[model samples]
Target chain A: MIAEVLTIGDELLTGNTIDSNSAYIAQRLTERGYWVRRITTVGDDVGEIMSVIREILNRKPSVLVISGGLGPTHDDVTMLAVAKALGRDLVLCEDCLERIKQFYEELHRNGLIDDPTLNEARKKMAYLPEGATPLENTEGAAPGAYIEYEGVKIFVLPGMPREMKAMLEREVLPRIGERKFIQKKFLAEITDESKLAPILNEAIERFRVKIHSSPKGFGKFIGIIIFAEDEAKVKEVVEFMEGKGIRFMEGW
Target chain B: MIAEVLTIGDELLTGNTIDSNSAYIAQRLTERGYWVRRITTVGDDVGEIMSVIREILNRKPSVLVISGGLGPTHDDVTMLAVAKALGRDLVLCEDCLERIKQFYEELHRNGLIDDPTLNEARKKMAYLPEGATPLENTEGAAPGAYIEYEGVKIFVLPGMPREMKAMLEREVLPRIGERKFIQKKFLAEITDESKLAPILNEAIERFRVKIHSSPKGFGKFIGIIIFAEDEAKVKEVVEFMEGKGIRFMEGW
Candidate 1:
């Protein structure tokens, strides 16, 4: 399976905020054997968001994960963008409204300060697209929404790291857990890449491995990663390089 | 100015490594009033790297900041990728070689203990594409390279945050300081967006304002921002909205 990540926020694009969400999502998706082909960041502009979503959809990733937006603020328009990308209308759903009301009541019962700002934030969560499945947010007031349209599952989560991370772990990962993939890394310290060129060539020829060679600065360090579905094939390639007098480094 | 960020690494795409490099670049670029349009992360695959570089170029981003693949390891193929993207041949520069040698000598003097592994790391940093300008890295053995090809200024920095941040702050930012841009942000609570919609339209018609309105969940928790060249015009729009009973939130 393949996925693409879209992080929507002016803060990220303008450098007011750091985007740790996309990185975290990409890492998790890769570990699950899904290739995240591209990651995009754009301002809160709906047109830009729509263009990016359309472009990535044409590329046809099975899943598209979007983080940011989902706040009760003016720049939070991720859900709107997703709907526009799918050519769907931004319709407020009854379930979403109930979710928002329940969330507010819970907060009020918990003696959390009840203010207009909090209510507004809760109301924004209630305004989701029609036919969208609202994901429960145990971490924050913003309830995440998931919509499967055009054979692509679009997961819309809040911009807050705590909410996004929790929802992704609870709601998204399980749905994407069917695929299998293997990753192997090789680290070696070699100064002269030209000298090792012949050995690297030989190793690739000797073993059926997807080998990638990267030589670090002025010849002080070298690392390689061989990825493949077959563990034996991966090990064989690593063994071949080890036989060539290549010493492995700390991180496998 | 507009910039695109390309952070290359299998570790970054994988869950094992967290990519703090792109965020660092994005923050620095945004601070300089440069809009980071997109961030692309690719594995060590040469074809994928080439495609991403081409796509970023097609978007006409003035600056392209790339990190990773500068290590002295077999997997480090950033320089090779740069060469392929720029259609340049890799050449070992004598100046870079001398820099590498000096770095090794410094390590030895500091009792860092020279090993074959360490020497190999330094050697890989010496190779660069033809006509590339080598940027020195005082923190590490790998020296970064910068090259302007076909109107796009490409910056190749180390993946290590400390080294990359230093080079960016010292070398990159100063060179980009000549450009002029003004950033304006406006925030308002959820005041009837319908009522403010026409006013925003009028403001956009009068001044070159990039206006975006997002609902935050309640009647008073709407957020909006206007980016424009004129500071006075931006403030006037906010004040106009405030006079229309639109409460200004923080970030104005």
Candidate 2:
């Protein structure tokens, strides 16, 4: 299945933040056999967020994972954008409100908070798109949400790395399940990538496998990765390299 | 002026590579007063690359920086994609070819390369979109390129972090010149972000400055930044905070 990741935050666009969240999500999805097509990042502008959601919907990715902008602050507009794009109202979800209340109460009990009252800004986290199911957040205050629109499964998570990761592992990954593919990495202590181009091209053409050669340094070493769905084809490529007197070190 | 960044590579999409290039470019552009609206990443597929370029063109960002997919491998189809997107033919640039030839010869003389002859794979780096000027790469084999379509200035740089940074500083930054803006940052120890929401919203509504409050921890500290073109307005916000008896630690 094909997937796309959309990260929303002005901090991201302004370079105040470096997005490691998208990389983590993409890696997890790829390991589960989803072909991640694109990763698009935009600021907190509602129009931009809405436009991106509309585009992703038009593309019809089997899975669309969105991160960031799910916070109590005014800048946190991802939920509102999603609601507008899906043509749904921003409604207070009782379950999400209950969770938020419990979160604040726990903080108060722990002497971390003086006021446990849910203010307007804090209550905003409980307002999700109508008909959306809230994904419980074990790490933070705002609960994530999930919705299905026209065969596309949308997963929305918080921008905080800790919260996003915990929710993704517990809530999102199970929905994706898993698939098997043959992936192998081989390294050679050679300098120029151009030197390996011919052999790598030949093996790619012969075995019908995707090969990537990255030059680490001018005269140092190169890392090559061979990937394909067919295990036998990957094996054949390895054999071809061995027969060509090219010694490759194993492991990624 | 507004800007956008497009990063191309399957490794990035597969999460094998984290994109720091876009962050670097966005930071530099923001420092120069360019409002970076979006940062888009796609795989090595030619169709996806071309589609993203077309979309960026349609959006008409004043400065569009593209990095990655400038290598000699078969997957490096960025130049081809840009050529097709602009409806221009891919043509060999004599200057780029001479530079590539000299680069290999120098590497051979330094005992870094055994073959000085430019192979087909190496020659691929010399091709540029028609009417595009090649930007000298002081650190790598492939030279960067610059092309102007309509009013948008398009910069295509190598994917390698070292080469991309070197070329950007030496070639791209000069073309953008400089722009001045008033910016300030303050840190405060506080628990709930909701507590500061009202004040921040009032500041944003009253002044033309942009404010961002980042929660460092649950009840530890928050970093706030105020940015604008007017220095007096930024100062007003700081004075206003003092008037409200909100003590904030100085410095970014």
Candidate of highest TM-score: 2
- Candidate 1's C-alpha runs over 4 A off are A109-124, A127-132, A149-151, A178-252, B113-123, B179-252
The residue-by-residue lDDT of candidate 2 on B1-252, one tens digit each, is: 999999998888878888888888988887777889999999887899999999989998999999998887667889999999999999999889999999989998999877788888789999999999899999999998999899999999999999999999999989986765555778866555666777877887887566777655454567788777667877789778667655688865
Give the C-alpha miss distance for residue A234 in model 1, angstroms: 11
lDDT of 1 by residue, B162-198 (tens): 8898888777777666544355555665434556677
Docking class of 2: medium
| Steric clash count of candidate 2 | 0
Scored by TM against the true chain B, the candidates give: 0.82, 0.88
lDDT by residue for model 1 over A1-252, one digit each (tens)?
A: 778888888767655566788878987787576777777777777888888889888888888998887865555677888788888877776676776677667666766534434344446667777778888777776778888877888888888788899999999988876654466776677645667767777876766334555544434456566656568877776777778877777464
TM-score of chain A of each: 0.82, 0.85
C-alpha lDDT (0 to 100) for residue B237 of candidate 1 = 73
CA lDDT of each candidate? 0.73, 0.85
